[model samples]
Target: MAVYTHVPAEVLDALLTRYAVGTLVSAKGIAEGVENSNYLVETTKGRFILTLYEKRVAAADLPFFMALLDHLSAAGCPVPRAIPARDGTQIQTVAGRPACLIEFLSGVSPTTPTAAQAGAAGAALARMHLALADFTGARPNSLGIAGWHQLAANCGDALDRIAPGLGGRVADELAWLDAHWPAALPQSVIHADLFPDNVLMLGDAVTGVIDFYFACTEVRAWDLAVAHAAWCFDPGGTRFDPALSAAMIGGYEAALPLSDAERAALPALARGACLRFLLTRAWDWLNTPADALVTRKDPLAFLNRLDAYAGGGLL
Candidate 1:
């Protein structure tokens, strides 16, 4: 349903000629993603995900994403590998968009994650960080503070339409983050978006960490903060689960202990993470076309998280 471009059958068949992945049997549009058109592609050899990078994804960044996936997969992290074409390039053009076939990984994304699942996800995240510690690739987080400011400006008065006083609250939060955000902490390639949907789990073990489009080089613990904002609360952000939070941190620490500075910066980082989502969701709410296939996420869900993070102690 999130498909933005429809790839015709003949075009798909022609594209399959570049890969030795066997002739395409079927290709069904995947409904779960927002930024790219994805398909559950079946071939004579095996099943794979064919992603046609949409407008939001920059063509220049494709190589960085491919390299990151290759690095993580080779490091034994539970991530999908970008299947190279017979020409040895992972990137190609399909439906007039940059595309790649990814090795299919098995598992379901938990709808309502248990503490054990949260713990497993946290450990998997830490492993990804550790594995990418030596990766030479670098990409800036475009949705960082500067991008948040741009979104706030783009939203303008619409923020109040979403919820009263949201614009003011976002402005205040941005100023606070600019002053307080951690600067000297350890840095690495991080999966900036690690929501429940991005992680695929089998029971309590993580089978895959998919959707690395938002991946970037940033403070390592801020990645933990992003996960904390995403996984430690109920879907509506109405209830906090201290046990789940503790378990997540415990699992992460078990894999790679957090530094003292990282520990000290968690609260602010969590607040920044919350604001990042709140701003983006607000922008999307106001801008997405009425007939768009993707669901319009309620920006207020993260506004609740921003408020909770402001109160302190949730982390």
Candidate 2:
């Protein structure tokens, strides 16, 4: 059974009443993410995902995330479309947390995604990026440099236990990033976390993407690098899938070709992406409160990725 932050039936009923959707038949937690509390809500009309924004997501940024989905969906992107409330608001306060209902995308995340499937994911992501090219809204990078620093500070005490020298490594990486980070890359809305878990597929075809909580405005190449980290690395981290990376890049380049500078910086950007996930996973492992209903992701999985990038050379 999955851990669920219980929502009383009465409150759920009231929430449903505020929407055009029918009465809720049942609700259960969707146990895949570490950030927000998600529930699979079945209504007489259809199934939907009820997301209760957690601490990591700022309330102010909810509009951008929601609007981005709407924009993307309008432009034929395979992302969940927000179900507007009777009051026409895309988001609402529920149980003291900002909450909203989204049309549940039908598909499962491929556990062992093939190169073709990865290529499809890359294509879908590129389409999403192009669709939102004209979007002018601004949202902070939730998992960018600033958040990395804060996470390290919060989990400073646990570094020795989780991973030795992680603290110093984080400091050094931060310094290196501050000095060498691209200042004039092509900026756009990026789905900062494009991991396999966030992508859904039906058979070999890509279906939809979820977990836009980390979406923000940033370098497009950084987004590509993050996708590479997720698609290229196996769980054990000993294996490398060059074909998968190539397929993904091929699909993306088909939609939006990378600039020479973007390609040049991809190696370092991939390294930075690796470290970002490593630090967050470590912090979550150590600092997730005992009573919190969240699973701690493996920090070593990302550490292994960092190691691979070090030797594999990001060409």
Candidate 3:
């Protein structure tokens, strides 16, 4: 099972009472994620995920994350609905960190998604973006250009060893981005981390999408680009499945057609998307605390992706 942090039986009992979620039958840490502490809570009422937002998640942005989930749930999207506390607030403090409970979305994240599965995920993401088009709030990008640079700074010493010329190449790429990154595009709420691990599936259908801690307001196309980086390429990144990529993009376009400008900028956005993951993984691999039980994801996986995008003639 997963190792949870500092959760006492009394605190679990208190949460059960506050939410009227019946008796807490069991509670254990969820093992898949690396960022936050999650517990799978089984109550007489049902199963729920109790999240202890780590320091990486900004407290100020908690409202946006909760509100977005509530909004998406109302829109018929298969996202977890945040359960309110006894005080009727969607958020509360637990273990001195922002915490909330969400109805557990049943289904496992696909280990290897088929082409049709990728299409469905893309369609669902498009529908989500459309649903949140009119949402009247904003949250700073947790993994935006600035965050990317900060991560790069932290991992500067390791880049040369991880991938030749990666350090200088990324520096140049950032310089170019500073001059040319999109000032404006179709803005909406986006699931900035739409990786396969966060998309849960049951049989041939997608049951739900989880982990909205990276949600933010940005060019909607950037979300698509991120999804592309995750879904379109394999780990080594040499193999390109055009059919899968096309299916996903096709599904998305069917829901909300991409504008000419959005299409034009997608390639560059995909490059940025590639670099974003590469830098984060590199930093995490180099700096992960020795005591942390989480395994650092491979930075080379994303570097190979960058090489692929460069070779594929970007979009």
Please, what is the whole-model Cα lDDT of each candidate in the order they appear? Answer: 0.90, 0.82, 0.82
* Candidate 1 lDDT tens digits, 1-315: 167788988888898899999998998987665688888889899999989898778999999999999999999998998898898989998878999989999999999889999999989998999899899999998998999999999899989999999999999999999999997899988999999999998999899999999999888899999999999999888888998899899999999999899999999999999999998888878987776567778889898988998998786
Q: List the residue pairs that clash in candidate 2.
A: none
- For residue 204, model 3's alpha carbon misses the true position, in angstroms, by 2.6
RMSD of each: 1.1, 1.8, 2.0
- Per residue, candidate 3 scores C-alpha lDDT tens digits across 147-219 of 8888888788689887788899889878877776775887777999999888989875789999988898888
Residues 1-315, candidate 2, lDDT per residue (tens digit)? 123366777888999999999999998876675788788889999999888887777888888888888888888888997799888988987787888888888898987779898889888888888887888777867678787788778887677687787778777777877777785889898998999889999987888887888888898889989999888878755677888889889988888888999988887788789888988888768767787666678887877877677664655
Model 1, 8: alpha-carbon shift in Å? 1.1
Native-referenced Cα lDDT, model 3: 0.82
What's the TM for model 2?
0.94
Clashing pairs in 3: none
Q: What TM-score does each of the candidates earn?
A: 0.97, 0.94, 0.93
What value of lDDT does candidate 2 attain over all alpha carbons? Answer: 0.82
